[model samples]
Target: MTGLSTLGRLAPLGAAVAAVAERLRPSVVTIENGSGAGAGVIWSADGLIITNDHVVPGDQARVRLGSQDVVPARVVGRDRLNDLAALRVPREGLPAAEVGDSRALRPGQLVLAMGHPLGLSHALTLGIVSALPTDDDERELIRADLALAPGNSGGPMVDAAGRVVGINAMVASPGLALAVPSHVVADFVTHIGEPAPWLGITALPVVLPPDLRRRVGVAAGLMITAVERGGPAEAAGLLPGDVIVAIAEEPVRHPRHLLEALARTPAGGDLDLVILRGGQGHRLRVAPARRAPQADVPPARSAA
Candidate 1:
């Protein structure tokens, strides 16, 4: 009788999950470039689709909608730094995923991911938010304990309420997946063609010593390896070998976090940076410059 009661209680939850998956199926899409295939999310009813920049390497591809309709899609904008790309299909009144506040997400909360994994169409996977950005770490990616395959690169990672919270990005390890938070997606979508703010510096993540960590109140920092000549960073007196701990009051443990903070700041606006030089902490102000007019080049991987 106890077992029967437990099953009865689970029946409703299973039904609810099924219902959510059904509703999301229409918003998830299959993207196919000449070399390979991936998944995407219908970001708008007017045919704007969101996927990983790695998924669509070319200017054009094919999008398969829920209605089994296949249409040509043009790559509208690509942010290789964030690994996000926007595509536009020639369709309207499409079912679009409801955006959710990824900042509101908490660890251990339930999440559902939809994708066409391993050529399987519209597959659903269940998991929980393994972790979120922390003040000391400030990674822009959402870490989830979900199984993600190659084909899952750009599908929607929705909550139990069927609201899109993230885009399935990549598998970090076995049973661990990473996602680009929906808030980041919203920002990327809003400024599709605009030049991303640039801070001309190359840096790399470095672990701070215990004494430095205690003094600086940060676990790690990005060590500046090079500063572009005549750029904002160099003009601000930033030198190589300096370790940057925070940007505009936001802790940035990764280059992506720094880039995201720069993206939020207006062009030519003053930016406050907290850094350590020779094991001593100091604050400096710099203005981010605009990227030169060119094709979307990947941000310097060493650090930007």
Candidate 2:
């Protein structure tokens, strides 16, 4: 019968989903930080875990492993802007999640989310990729039409193959969730201890004139307001009032875009800056310096 045939075809899919969930449960962990509990993903065999910054705001927390074994975890690094934190546990040979290329993901792709929802452990949810970052978007987030709860933050969003493509960060709205892309997490892990690169300039977003916009191929850019004395921008002969159109070929339409581009560049690396001054487009090569550690100074509105 038609109904029987449909059920027969769906049986394999249901079995496959079960198998993937079983395989990935070991990599998902429950993190308790006194405020509440959330989930974390085992990122390495040597006990490196990744979770949301808000989950582990302090330097220490407890991680409940798949075996129900509770262990002490240390917050090794935190990137609050991206809402991601890296934790190290005193354990070895853990089952690590397979990281997938989020850049390869397309809208409508089937995805799975695993977490501890509402005190229930190892809960799984089904969903699909709803959208991706656009040129005007400020942050790189994976938007999903997935059901997520308070306890789902810091969990892994995997593809059908059980490879992690994103880290669930927050619920955007009803029936909508936003996740930090896996590629961005990889970059954060790579530069965990390194100081963020500094451009030594303050800037604000400004709309480009119609003729300049058509010529530059962008509608808006960051206008440099001040150049630090004897800094990279000064050394590169960059003056205030210059509009930054792009950095290393990546368009800069807002201050956040400039900050994101600078974060991607390594300290002491050469930056290819495309700028406009006096209605003329120019390219400048500036070597960014590593920002020195400072106290709780408020982040400047500029790119640095």
Candidate 3:
């Protein structure tokens, strides 16, 4: 391919990629915390953003808009299991990114990653979807060959049409970058601000004794270290030393597993929990109540 011939062949593709990058640039923001900084995608016009849970690890973060103006943002919610987090900025009328359906993505489809990689803002990398990994429950993930770095975490991965299909999570290897699918991001944002069921208890994962494991038919369980005063757990006669074996028939091994089960439980709905207290396994029905909103500072600043 001669240089002139190559230019003629590649110019159109280059122009398309540039257009997509331009459209997505304004919707991508820099998310900074005490430790470091990453990228975030504007998820709503009213300043709701989505980023990686690790990027916004603290209770608050500082979001820098395209104008280089920084604003304080509160952490609305985090789903560490899915490695996604939501933030509420103290502003509105922000330009949210155009989200597309990841389920419609196909291997070898052209995509672009827009974010700050190696602290370079508005960096764009082009690649094709290498694979799509699905979990047992049909949760999908995008695996691309895009070059990404630390600062690319939480950035938007948009298709050639400039529609976001996923959020760049991490570089799995030299050239493979993994992204949390867009459908999961949409679901996370929808429930992040809503009041879900709450069973007030602090617990940790614990290995069951051999005999106890046999009795509970599990290798591990969550040990309730503390039951909140006047909370649903206490109301259900759950003691601090109780070990949770299952919830709604699903096996509970990790603390997050229990949390996922609780999140699916409807407010004011009965939850059947199988627990082992004092080496005695028993089942209890508890009605989970709506979670009380935390006393966090409201969104008060404006930068839009």
Over 169-215, each residue of candidate 3 has an lDDT whose tens digit, in order, gives 98879899999989878877878768766777777677898987786
What residue pairs clash in candidate 2, if any at all? none
TM-score of 3: 0.72
* lDDT (CA) per prediction: 0.87, 0.88, 0.82
Q: What is the number of residue pairs that collide in model 2?
A: 0
Error of 3 at 196 (Å): 4.1
lDDT string, candidate 2, 147-244, tens digits: 99988999999999999999999998988999999999998898777777876888877899898888768788889999999888999989999999
Write down the TM-score of every candidate: 0.86, 0.85, 0.72
Clashing pairs in 3: none
The alpha-carbon deviation from the true structure for residue 21 of candidate 2, after best TM-score superposition, in angstroms, is 0.8
RMSD of 1: 2.9
lDDT of 1 at 124: 94
* 6-44: candidate 1 lDDT, tens digit per residue: 999999989989999999999999999999999999999
Q: How much lDDT does candidate 2 score?
A: 0.88
Minimum summed lDDT over a 10-residue window in model 3 is located at 295-304
In model 1, pairs of residues that clash are none
The parts of candidate 2 lying over 4 Å away from their true place are 202-206, 209-217, 224-230, 234-242, 248-250, 263-268, 276-283, 292-303
